[model samples]
Target chain A: MTSAPALVPRPLARARPLVEPALREAVDRLHPWLARIVGYSFGWCAADGSPSATPGGKGIRCALALLAAEAAGGAARDAVPAAVAVELVHGFSLVHDDIMDGDELRRSRPTVWKAYGTGPAVLAGDAMLTVAMATAARTGSRAALGELVGALDWLVRGQAEDLAFESRAFTGPDAVTVEEYLAMASGKTGALLGCAAAMGAALAGARGEAVTAYRDFGRHLGVAFQAIDDVLSVFGDPHRTGKPAGGDLTSGKKTLPVLEALAASTPASSRLARLLLERPLAEGQLTEAALLIDRAGGRRRTEAWAHIHHQRALHALHSAAPLPCPKADLTEVAAHLLHRTA
Target chain B: MTSAPALVPRPLARARPLVEPALREAVDRLHPWLARIVGYSFGWCAADGSPSATPGGKGIRCALALLAAEAAGGAARDAVPAAVAVELVHGFSLVHDDIMDGDELRRSRPTVWKAYGTGPAVLAGDAMLTVAMATAARTGSRAALGELVGALDWLVRGQAEDLAFESRAFTGPDAVTVEEYLAMASGKTGALLGCAAAMGAALAGARGEAVTAYRDFGRHLGVAFQAIDDVLSVFGDPHRTGKPAGGDLTSGKKTLPVLEALAASTPASSRLARLLLERPLAEGQLTEAALLIDRAGGRRRTEAWAHIHHQRALHALHSAAPLPCPKADLTEVAAHLLHRTA
Candidate 1:
């Protein structure tokens, strides 16, 4: 069942003032050029180092961290470093992801690799990764660095598989399976989100079952988030997505719905598979392909599939949420992620 | 004053059997293909995943880490995690360095990026970096991770400036000065080495002053090591170097000798200056550049410069060598680094 919407405080908005300022302060200490690159990546500065008020990511992951802390019966203020660390790590992955996937735009702006040359972009990502661990260290927990770095391995593994899947999706007879897609999504999206929540809870001194449940909640939410993202990538309103229509279909990324549609035995699936194998989908082919995907029930299947994960996430969130902890806002956060346009 | 050579035990040889296997065990836990890339990068496997012993480095850094543990009166076994962590970090840097510099050969074999495509290599390096931090966390010390992650920031900053220097050296009139070169070297080479020693000592329960002294010893040794490496890059016998002659010069790397010669005003230095700005070295220009570097006293000056750092390392080692701890093997490791031909 859908959880009740947040009636009072907005969790992410509350976390932003603390999270954003701390993130800016942390990266500000990087080397001059690195600081400039970070400033650009985070929407604080333009390419020429001038101020730019480009709104960055909604800090959803950052909010997950702080909310996890508050939901474990701790003050949100106590988890500021944890919030900073996860956001930095998320930015690190985004910077490197753009380079690896050869994507040109992120959040309606040029990717770091596109705006800067590959060398600078890659190194800048590396600096961010290093800074993430360093920032986490200030949390004074033996487990904070371990949890974040451990999540990174899963994240990288997921990315590696994602890259490998692109070449195999249409050609290889033994293409990646739906189960493999779920595993990859779990690692790529869910692992870091899980770490973000766990780090926040651990730093708040919420040990044992509370930590595990929070981590599970984040992971399932992440997979559900990935499924929703896949659905939107194909059918989203560009005005809301801040991206051109059919970006993922054009990029040939092996998102879950596409894989599911490809695996179907329907005639529309046959057309979609043929179109995928034909390489560059011709001009109007994208619109036709989207219709074919819908006809093959890919969109419905992915959306329905997401609800399973959403239910699991809610289950985990409720199971371990102590009565004293503030979870109303967390439930609202989850609902927003599920209902967001972009 | 040169410390007497090891008459008691071989430092690196004794440390290798301990370091190598632990490294293997560490990466063995990474994702499937990621493990294979790591195996190839570490020279434990060929491109096809078949076993191959192409000979990794001398494990000099690894030995330094383990020896630091012994020097702090801890069992060598107690520092295996630290040793593995440092070596993994070193390999992580090497993998990324090859990609960044587009070098094909490492230890006389194909670089990771060359053998595996850039995408897999980059992700593999990311995996290695993740594992390095995770393995360090097993030491049960929050300080271990903090120290290691801090050193990584310095290392990345050093590499960034080193790349920046390459462009400035040939394009701008204000080429990198000796002090700037030294600072970069300290960050690039000294920082990780310093971290290694500090991690080992800290793991062994060595507190405050002892750890600082150990860190200083490693940093000084790293600079000296860098200087000697510059000398060998230009002048060492190819058979010993395991690299084609003048590779660094042809690659236009701003090594110490080249930087020193560029700053000199002698006829040979003047000729060298013109040669460097003329773009990529022409046929036989590498040989000529080598001679010009020598004529400008770059070889002598760099060697003498190394000796000063060498003295500082020895002084630090002696001052910090506790009575209960072993020193003979540590002294040998020092002499070996200072005097090795390759």
Candidate 2:
């Protein structure tokens, strides 16, 4: 048997532009009828429900799934359903999350609940969840189906934990610490990504060792992705990010930066904690909170933390056995995710 | 190869008192740990969370599940998990339903949300749902797990439909027809009961025709049970039923009686339709609605419908292939469910 190849760096100029087209093509090939509904909900269509042909995100999850499969010497086509399933599940989670978070906009457009009523929006989310599970059960291997189900269980558990956290009277500074955040995100974000990669590996009929390696690679990449997201939530350009500056802080969402800031603050941190506890922050208070976060060196710390995870992700990919051409594409995808502005 | 036993005409008096103890013992046996949490939330326990030993209602779902398994020749011990699972799911649905319906009391005690905050109550319901699924997965066979999952899917679908119905601006008098109501209740109620029976049969290792027979018996019993519940909701004693008289009519729940009444009435049905449309009736409107239902002979017609389904359940039990002691116990269980007042 051929050993996996060492991770090779592709020339960034040539590799970067190909990702979007490939993702668009992959999504285009999903079941045409179901795609109509899913595509519309994902904002690939207009209010009148006309197809817009505008592609969504870079398809990071699908790329990881296919890459892991191909790295295991499986055909990428065999992993398509798993890829679609992951994306659909992701979309389903986003729809519900938006409602729970009371966010009015996503991807610079009105959210499902904002555009449609909550009732229909909820139904749409449920439909997506059902369709994802159905696709997995129908097209995926029994083992892959089992893995996907476990991943979903993790996702639900993560959501429950996050919601529970939000409702608490006071969460300790350590409660939202980096390690705890990572654990929560592991279930919230990493589980599905790892499942995607592992599922793809399973589809390729990969043996034990290679599948484990691919899953590890995917998990590291998922952490790296979320770390980058936390950074963007605080520091990215509002125009590029398509979100207001310091949206996470304003919303009282405890992202990596805020958590780090609270952990590292001097005696002054207690005052900040008191302010947050007193009542919902005013607009001016949000700006001050951002300033405190910056003064506490949170931005630098979070960035350094993100960079470490990024390096770890690359290390994981390198350690895995050499993948074929399609599998190698995943490394490029990982880089894109880590560096993505929006 | 022995056929399932025929139902003997045992005296109702002999079996009536044994029903409560057997149900209590079974519930006590099934959920040793989780049941305490559920029991407290379900008002089977006091506010301090101690078991009140206050008697529960009919335990219809558990009895049906156990009976189905037995009639299919499964060991009762092996089927206990399925029985517990169905009961928990039913209880979970009822807790959420009561919240949605704004009902203040259940079993002559405060509802979960009335006692606990909505947030905790929602979590309690979710926890129960989680426990039910986990129990099914852990305790049942692969086929039984699949059946349970399918039943859950149906339950969610039924809830979606029910929620959808509540928000409708106009369900044509034609829209609230008997067939539609049956379909709704089948998903809302019958699916879990069918799953319970099917799971029990699966655990018993019943296959082919016996499994189908048990499933049909459970489904018919569920319909009969719901029909009786509808009758109770409108016409039963408030003290014993633990609900207001004309509860379904007042809530505009569109039960079988209301549907039958609306469908069978002459042009005067429009007057009753208007009463329904003007829901949350004023001071004397509840009494007037009850009189209107009586004028339309809805009570008697709905009773006849319940009797028909009750007979169908018995017919199904009789036609099932013979088992030994368990099957006889199931027949007694069926009779007790059909004739139960509270």
Candidate 3:
């Protein structure tokens, strides 16, 4: 759990050149050729229910997976299936989570349920989950299946807890802190990413401590990614992030920035908290809440936290560097993830 | 597939006499000892969440699972885990299906969603599903896992189709026939049972034709059981069935009896269909609809169909009987299932 150094050699930075093409090819190959309904919903095709050439997301999970495998001294080909599976599951979770959270926007477009309706979205997510398990099963290794299932279990458990939290009214503004929020995020977001990395390593035949190191690296990196995301939710540029600033604030989400602001706020900031939580925020209130978090130094605090975890992730990668694998690719992948803006 | 004959002794039925007690004991042992807030919505526990001696239903799925193993010439001990897994998955499906179908009463008691909230009910069902998969995984062998996953895939697919059928405003009064309904039922119910038998056989080293026979027996029996239940839904005495007369009619559910009635009915049956489909049926309309189905000979036809499946199942049992297992217990189980009043 120790943090990595703030600076390291950039030998793996060249991974950026290969990451996108490799990821797109892997995902395209894994895409279901038969079920058009599912294939369309996956955003590989157009919303008009026709096949299209649009690629989805940044493919961060797949990158991490491939890198982890290579870091474990295995070929990227060996890890491609696991990488694809992770991406599918991650997308599935996002689609379903959007439905549950009532968010209408994803990838700067209408959410799955918004476009296809709730039932289809649910079914699509279920299909994705099934495909993920099916993919793992087809890989035919008990240990690999075990890793996948374990990751999924944690992911679902985290989601269940988050949903439970959202459904209830929190009594006080500062009922939970940034640390507690991190725990939730660890499960909700970090676990899957960690699993993606660990599973890649596992598929590559990395056993014992190397597997643990890869998993820990992903876990720490996931936390950092989420922490950065929380910061972006409040302070990032809308054009770059593809989301309106203070979107989470308007939705009354108790993300790290909001939680940190609540803890650090004075009585004046209480007014902002009340405005955010008393009811749905108006457009003007969203701006006010974002400003309040800024004034309270919540944005800076979250950024600092993200940086710490990012460093720790890289450090874990370094520790795992000596485990007899090609360390360059994984090291580059970890750095790219830490530095990602979206 | 041709239906099997009626007089051949089923191995599941014959083995049941010896395995029933042991199966019950195994279930008892497997039941969580914590006395926690489990099985509350299942109505197998009281408000305080304490286990009730007479809480669970007839446990038909459990019996079939054990019988399948025994019929496959596997010892009950080896098959008990598979049996338990099948039953758990069955229960999980029931809980979720009730929620999706908006069913309030199951087995004459409030459904999980009605007893608890939707969240708890969903969670409970999910927990059961997780347990089922985990149990299957623990049972070991690639074949067992494959069978379990295949059954699960069919089960979920059947449910997705059922939900799709129900979500539409007009599911066509006679759009689907008895055969289609039976196919749905087979996927929704029979697949797991077949898997149970197959898994048991696999565990027992019942290879090739013996395994196929056991699976066939279980599948036919499952279809027969459902057909009988459908008949009971319409024509059987409410008190004996432990459900309201014409419950399916009231729900506008496309059961075999109603489908058969609609298919055979002339202009006279149109009124019944309208009554069932226009809106939720009133108590008076329910009675009128039931009488109309009787007048249309739907009741007799459905009963005859059930009898045919029952005979088929019996024949399948006979075909599976040469696998070197006790005949008495399997025969008893088959009789108990085919002849059950509720």
B56-85 per-residue lDDT for model 2 (tens digits): 545655656655666676555667777766
Model 1, range B1-342, lDDT digits (tens) per residue? 244243424777778898888899989988878899999988899988999978787787788788888889887877788889889988899888777787888778888888988767878888888899888777778667767987898899899888788677542567788888888888898888888888888888888788888888888988998998898999887787777788888888888988787677788888998897665787588889999999998888888878898899888888776534457777777778878776
Report how far residue A335 has shifted in candidate 2, in Å: 1.9
Q: Mark the regions of model 2 whose C-alpha exceeds 4 Å error after superposition.
A: A1-41, A44-58, A109-135, A138-142, A167-175, A207-213, A237-245, A266-279, A311-322, B1-59, B84-88, B95-140, B167-174, B242-247, B266-270, B322-324
The better candidate by lDDT, 1 or 3, is 1
- Local distance difference test, per candidate? 0.82, 0.65, 0.66
Rank ordering of all candidates by lDDT, starting from the highest: 1, 3, 2
C-alpha DockQ of every model:
0.61, 0.12, 0.18
DockQ of 1: 0.61
For every model shown, the clashing-pair count is 0, 8, 16
lDDT, candidate 2, A1-342, per-residue tens: 122224323422332243334334544543343344456666578655686865465567776776777777777677777777787778877766766667777766777767765544554555566456556655526656666766666666566556555654334743566676777677777778887888888887876666666666777777767777887877777776666776776677867777777778655455556666745677788767766766776767776766676677667666667465764577667666666766
Query: Which tens-of-lDDT digit does each residue in A1-342 have in candidate 3?
Result: 233334432423323234444434433433232144455555566666576765456666776776677777777667767876787678778866776677777666677768776545655555566556666776786766776776765676666666555644433753765676788778788888888788888888887677777778888888888887887787777766766666777776778877777777676458666776655777777788888887777777777777788788777777776344456655655565556555
The 10-residue segment of model 3 chain B with minimum total lDDT is B29-38
lDDT: which candidate is best? 1
Clashing pairs in 1: none
CA RMSD of all predictions: 2.8, 7.1, 5.9
Best by TM-score: 1
The TM-scores that each candidate's chain B achieves against the reference are 0.94, 0.84, 0.84
Query: In model 1, which regions exceed 4 Å deviation?
Result: A1-9, A170-173, A323-325, B1-9, B170-173, B323-325
